[model samples]
Target: MYYNILRGGINLKKENITFLDVLTLFIGCFLMSLSLNMFFNPHSVAPGGITGFAIIVNSMTGIPLWVINLTLNIPLFILAYKILSKKDCVKTILGIIFLTLTLKYTIGLSEIHVTDDVLLASISGSILMGVGLGFIFRINGTTGGTDLLGLILNRFFPSLSVPILMGSADCIVVILSGIVTKEIEIGLYSAISLYIIVKISDIIIEGFNNSKSFTIISDKYKEISSSILEELDRGATILKGEGVYTGNKKNVLLVIVSRRQVVTLKKLVKEIDPNCFIIITSINEALGNGFKSIE
Candidate 1:
């Protein structure tokens, strides 16, 4: 039904919001609230950011996490409206509202008691929270707090990355939480949780359909290209390159292939050019004629 609201369904180039995006935001926010209520809050594990700060405050004041989160974000929402695009700000507001509602209603649905083993709680909570955050990020929605701060700072420091900025802001909260609580272990565990959260979020946002890219530098460029095209059925791009050491001009072959095809491509390249220089690296996502089609 929400898909009908958009002129171009699943075509992200359009400026309007789609129903799928709203659904994703709802799920993402719900998962975030679930992770906070079920895992992080009960165990007193503050993994950083707004939710983490709320946990710290709730522990001390005995206030509900949802209330603390909303109260803290009111000012940030104003700042976000000024700094971020209207669409982004609106989506963030929705995410915050959904998260607050979910926290209020579903906090007591299921309780996880890994408090005895703080490490287990930290790790497990990090995963649940990270996955939720990953989904939110994938859909281009944020739950305000450090996200908005990161955006505001990014405008001033264009060279700095937003994730790094946000992570740094979260770290400050975590470190201060540790200081305030007078527990070094809490900070350390929070750091571990934060690391896991970032990693899991990255995997979720980028997806697991990872691929390898190969850059081949060889004199037998023609043969390598032909083998890749005819045998592997993969496209190869030949780029003109010059060697700095020898001042020799050569053609560099660039090919992107699935992880399973890495060995085969290596063998094929070796067969044609034994003395060729080949560099292979992992790529997040590859979209093209033979790979995943982008909509």
Candidate 2:
């Protein structure tokens, strides 16, 4: 009975955490804090989440970012601990401590003056924060913020969903930042930065192994499946599906292929059956014979 929360979307088994885990957490927290001070905090660009809100507070009041993180995260952690298992709270606790310490130590980075342009600041900061969060999430931990708040709120309102709640909170905070700062551009730029953060973090977590998946419905399922296996050198699974309108049973062929083989697949299916129904989707990552083997 453990509750594991990943900021992006990674689920690591709850087992004995080694030194590597600690090192990874430290590095992640350090990078996030560094980005905050060097880029986001300096230029009044709150990306998203509790830290983003803290950035807004810092811009309004002269409060230190680390203090705000420490102040806000403590109560959230205490409240959330009521539901989250002790085993699950271990990395969360470490994540919070490491992030707080790093933010405090990196406080001087703000005055270091890395870049004057806000656009450059947003991109660089987003990249660093994304990478940092990716590493932290990969280990089944979070640095206590709206992420924990989202899960806690989900307990009361099960229908809302954690991601939706988290997203709503972040959007509100980002909008508030823009209004408070008296610049509409702030919100727009922050939104862009947030988008970049999510994308980069997804790439970091899932990897750049973009693959294609096909859901094929055709009378020539046998030929299509065979062609996929032999010519495309791929695997195809025959699935039993019933037509929603007709209530007739149908043979569905599921195929996975690399990006390079997408055109070949379309051509092959067309040559075999010109009127075949094909639905192609881009997959983030796929593991197996033709893809990366499970390590």
Candidate 3:
């Protein structure tokens, strides 16, 4: 079924998955499994989503975590194959298989048990898992489960955003943890873990190379734009605008600057035009000079 979908949707015959891609996926799976088996499962820290569900099920039924993980991901994988690209489905399948195998072999190893403290366990486990997951996602692959659901939501509702959907799903899974464990603390820790994982995943994926977009609405457009160019060494675009209330013609300055240069740019704008309306926002992935490259 997946094969037919792949043939129809993706140009797989022309674009082959590289060895480096496979290697990265394998390493990502290993890191994820190691984090789960050593840090999370041993400490009963749920990191949300299907992995959390697997942990709860394994706790109750004494079933292998890998088995539960595989079962939980299969349906999602099928859905991904139908709704998303076949290449995505194939990469997710590889990721799940690799993670399952890694977990099976490493489960019996001396559990790291990094910290007996539940809070510490939750934080640390979430960080490692989040970083590993981020690497997989960066390579256009997934660890399967609810991550696929997040992708699906992002595709169908372009305006809804991935973070919002991810948070909603994780919150539901964390709430379910409380019911399965019959403890309020379990739910709390699950929430903490989910938060840490999302935050750390964002950090890992975005890295320190963050950029910001600055929009300035000011009467002193020339002075502000000139100062920005001379001091910040960044280019600015002048957008023609009109104030609705006053019906006054205005030139808005739009610029993209690195995170490090944001304060400098803002100060320059403030000095040039005290009443300038300045708005700055983080750009997840910017492509161009002074930013990220798309290809």
* Leading candidate by lDDT: 2
All candidates: TM-score: 0.89, 0.85, 0.82
lDDT of each: 0.83, 0.88, 0.79
Measured with C-alpha atoms, the lDDT of residue 113 in candidate 3 is 55
lDDT by residue for model 1 over 54-97, one digit each (tens)?
98998899898889988888777776566766577667777888
Candidate 1 global TM-score:
0.89
User: Model 2: per-residue lDDT, tens digit, 39-70?
Assistant: 99999999889899999999989899989998
Q: What TM-score does candidate 2 get on C-alpha atoms?
A: 0.85
lDDT of 1: 0.83
RMSD of 2: 5.0
Ranked by TM-score from best down, the candidates are: 1, 2, 3
Off by over 4 Å in 2: 1-15, 155-159, 241-249
List pairs with backbone clashes in candidate 1: none
Would you list the rank order by lDDT, best first?
Answer: 2, 1, 3
On the 0 to 100 scale, the lDDT of residue 52 in model 3 is: 80
lDDT agreement of model 3 with the native = 0.79
| lDDT of candidate 3 over 28-132, digit per residue (tens) | 788878777877777666778777878878777978889999987887777666666556766777788899999898888425556778787777778878888
